[model samples]
Target: MSTPSHAAATAPRRRNETVIVFALSLAAMVVSMMQTLPVPILGLIRTDLGTSTAGVSWVTTATLLSAAVFTPLLGRFGDQHGKKPTLVAVLGVMVAGSVIAALATSLPLLILGRVLQGAATAIFPLALSVLREEVRPQKLPGAMALVSGTLAFGSGLALVATGLLTSGSDADYRDAFWMATGFAVLALLAVALLVPAPRHKTGGRTDFLGALTLGTALLLLLLPISQGHEWGWASPRTLGGFAGAAVMTAVWVLVERKVDEPLVDMRMFVHRPVLMANLAGILVGFGMFANFLGVSYLVQMPEALTGYGFDASILRASVQFLLPGAIISLLASPLGGRLVSRRGPRAALGLAAVLGAVGFAWLALDHRHSASVIGAGLVVGAAVSFGYAAMPAVIMASVPHHQSGIANGINSISRSTGSAIGSAVVTTILASRTLDHLPPGVPPLPAESGFTLTFGIGAAAFALVAVISRFGLRGGHTTVAAAEPAAADHSGRPTDKAVRTDTADAAV
Candidate 1:
């Protein structure tokens, strides 16, 4: 239907959009890599730094808490100021963090670097916001799927790379951080050059008080979730952490309600579809970490000692057992996007839930063989890809253009919380009961039953996702034009005659 001139103009625009998607996807992948890079090398780090297990655990915990604090705040900042500038600043910080991590000799210094890198978690939501502005509605789902897939792929890539880099007898864990530094720098350059500047801005004063309360609440909640096993689940610190989180959450809600311009709008925050999307995020997040940790640990168990494992080295666990799933996740992205485009996000999410449950059930029932572990992991990887594609779509469909960054940011935090819980649950289950009748001087290994229990729990989480998709999602689609609210100025007054046409209002 387009004329020659229109077609010619469209070609370049399409190319530009493609480049933009690539840059953002790369940035997202880098952030994901940062999160998982320490997983394979934690033991090495402990030895090098002479830290106890509890001390090394903080390396990962610091990043999680930092992400919880920064993601929503930076997301909202982008909405108010400008997404591109905010993205640039965040990436710059990531580069600095990676450099410091690469050079660090002390655990505290390394943890500081990780905290800075964790702030880059904001990149994912900001990328989604940019896609909304620059890409046509028809193309958005596919682009989002591609970007979302990178999170899983990058995570696996980190494990593989870390294993490979630290495989030698004298290898240093710092090598992995150096690799991250290179990738972060590349991502920074790509985003700077390729991504277009923001086309929409919601100028407003940041609610610093709201950010503080919410950040504190999340910190209190996640601290115990990540460290509960070490702290003893029934310890005063753990119980107090939960109690404080509940109190802080109540105070945050009250603060939000009273503010003229709040950090989060209570109406939108409580919207059924958005709420359901967040719930799905948590479950999906939990399932994801469960698969990663449960499989990695199970496979790497010394077969001679355990009599049930593959005796995989860290490298083998990463390359043989995990890399295939990551590749499948990347391959599934386009398919997931197609599903979202044709059947709506609810349908895509339902597919994710089905595949995830099946995958975990497979792992639970038959995990002795490499074929079983790899096959089940592939299915779960695809499920993760689909779930990732659908989540941002639900958010974009539910909220106005201006609120996209923070809305997606909140969803991101939900997923992180889920991942923390998944990791904790898996750790606790595996450590709960060690194998009986082990040889003298043998380290205590988890019983085979522990892996089965962990996978069963993962299956339950995904099954819950299916329940949410069926009961909680209604009117969950929107055309590109309708996604935008009525055009408004910095003061939030209408600046154009366009009506708010998004159908997600009733459903969300």
Candidate 2:
């Protein structure tokens, strides 16, 4: 009779938890949608802004760089000061960026807005950290998966939404930016009204020096990779940037080692599980972006001329090739959570790597037909959901609970770095390889072999992730021998009572 009473009492709490997760997930989706809102409309942007193709590419390049710079910085701040305020600040910035982009009449202004919008990258990791504080441990994995999967889902939806808004060839891309602004505004209100402020705070000093060094190093390293094709791979500018990156890396390591409370803990970061998780994040991210950019490009190639393409509009590419993948990603998210809760993150990652490996391998081998391309994309998108879901599990399991924000932030940066690399490589491959024969009046087209090579490389990266997860994920789910669960009121700082209660319930 008492047990029944306890269960009845807890029912409402569970219902509230469900509502909270739904709200947070919605906010996360809006942030992710903004990140990819401009992807399908770059050509239109080029024409609208009267910019050269090379110049307009900065819209994406600048966003990548800005995301890399801000995610870790703001994440660390959120961990020390507070997450809700930090998240609200980030959302506010995104809204401003979207508005700026919507009203921009010049290329530089649009790029500036994109740079600000890039801060939304921090939103995904922060949402996961908040889930840890708000949801019960038993429910945490599933809640985290929902949030993580939304990233892939929102990105795909963004493409589809952009296509709808700019359906006509002559439709201005600025409408897409306005749509982004609306989503951002909605997200801001949702966070402010629905989600309560953070009760957990791991008070610490902001590592300004460490952040500067890391940010500068990341910028130096990524600028060349993103723009190397235009500048010439062997040009002085690219080489100099790489050299500067190398020097900055050495300096950043020294600074981190000497600081009492470093921006990033050197010892924890290099722990086998944490190190491997970050590495796998890079490889998985590479495969994800490669699949996304490659599929969209392949379908849009004019079928009449290229023969291999579907002659699809941006709308068709998103609907026919991308939507199935997004749907599969949604289906895979909870499944991934179940796998993580049962066998562990290692198993989930292994599954992701296998799916990614097989997906890209099939794409490389049998891409002659348009249907094959769509099928491959569906598989790869599901793989991304698995990978994204598992990644936070690995990070959360390995790092101390208090460090979740900064730790996940670093992991997010790794993914962003991998995306830039994948984008650069795919661009280079397609640009370098060209069809051997073409009619006099026909414009140039990429050889089919370029796509084959890109998929093969993506397959190789995922295969490598499998090997890392298998060997390097030992003991990731277990606490360190000397450390017991810490006590605090906020969910981020779980008390002994809270831990035992969740563990007991899970055992039931």
RMSD (Å) of each candidate, 1 decimal: 3.0, 4.2
TM-score of each: 0.95, 0.92
Writing each residue's lDDT as its tens digit, candidate 1 over 207-314 gives 899999999999999999999999999999999999999999999999988988888877678766678989999999999999999999999998888889998999
lDDT of 2 by residue, 1-508 (tens): 5598899988977886787677778777887676678888898998878899889889988888898889988988888888989989999999999999999999999999999899888887787777778777777787888888887888788989999999985798999999999988888887787776787888978998999999999999999999999999999999999999999989999998888778887766775666887898889878878988888888888867777878888899888888888888878899988877765677778888899999999999988787788888888988889888888877776666667788889898898888888989999999899887888987778988899999999999999988876666643332221122334343232333322211221210
In order, what lDDT does every prediction score? 0.90, 0.82
Residue 503 local lDDT, model 2: 24
TM-score for candidate 2? 0.92
Q: Highest lDDT, which number? A: 1
Deviation (Å) of 5 in candidate 1: 0.8
lDDT of 1: 0.90
Superposed on all Cα atoms, model 1 deviates from the true structure by an RMSD in Å of 3.0
